[model samples]
Target: MDSILFIEIESSYKAIPLLVFKRDHHSSIIKKSHVRIYSDAHALLMAIEEQVQEFQKLIEQQTIQMIEDKERELNEHISHLQASAIHQLTLSQQQWFEKAEEQLNKLLDAQEKRLSEAIADARNSMASAIRNRLIKMNQSDSLIGYLSDALHAELNDVEKSLVIVKSYSDNGTTLTIENDDCMVSINTQELLSELKSCLENISDD
Candidate 1:
């Protein structure tokens, strides 16, 4: 039988040992035991470091995913806002154009009405002026004929002896009678005036 030594590690609050090891009487194996303990401790530390690195990679990946999601959300929001603004602008422009067109139509209608009225007034004025001119022309022709008949009646016997001359001026019409002895002048306007007064008196009677 080989001589063996037993060692136990325990906490102060527990009666059972947390760890147990068996040692043999080979003095040279004790050094190998120390080496084994160091190797196991180093392996555990390596595993723990690897686990920490994996955890760090996981945290970095989660952060990157969160950042990407936030950027996507922000981009979508901006796009929505731009679309809404464009729609609103289009509606506003349409309304403005419609209003402007309506106003322009109204202005055109009013201008057309005014032009028509002005044209009617001008035509009426021209017609009245032409009618008055025709009446005046008729009256002047009648007056000239009456004057010629009176002159002929008065100088019936001396028609060949008398040289009669007629002149027109802005003030009135004039008649000149010339003979070997003297010349006579008569204003046709005064004769016409006296004739008009005689006609008026006869009408009143």
Candidate 2:
């Protein structure tokens, strides 16, 4: 693969859309057809981290090899030019040296630019992958059914006249419940009925 990648998927029952990783385009095949599967936040992140380490090591090795090869090539070229200049007219040989020097300089500049661009592109892709991984990791995995049931039960104890409700998330539950009815227009009977209906629906499920 040209790049290392991972995938994650999430589905919700409350008409919520399936959540898929924003990145990851690697392909696989099964049964003569392509198949794409999902991974959790933890596994996806670990894969990315491992890929990053591998890329760094590859880059380092390539850089060392390029440097050594370029040095040896330059030295050989310089020696050849010096030998030719010694048998030629002085002024003619000076022009050859200048031309060769400029050529080498241009070659070095081009190589440096190419390397810089590749590294920058790699960094941008890695950042994007890491960002997506973190978002998935932070997302809560509690089922929507569980959350709805729990919230409905808690709302039952709240008075009908109350306009605002708060639940702490420190214990992994934080929600805001709002009662639109004013105190003067409080319908305790209707609120109790609604709560009962919700409970019954949960039991049926």
Error of 2 at 49 (Å): 99
lDDT of 2 by residue, 114-203 (tens): 998887777666655654543343324333234444445455633334333433332332334444432122122333345555544543
Candidates in order have lDDT scores of: 0.66, 0.52
Model 1: residue 71 alpha-carbon error in angstroms? 1.5
Model 2 spans with C-alpha error above 4 angstroms: 1-88, 140-205
What is the per-residue lDDT of model 1 for residues 132-162, given as tens digits with 9 covering 90 to 100?
A: 5543643386666666666655656244456
Total clashing pairs in model 2: 0
Q: In candidate 1, which residue ranges exceed 4 Å CA deviation? A: 1-44, 130-205
Give per-residue lDDT, candidate 2, residue 118. 86
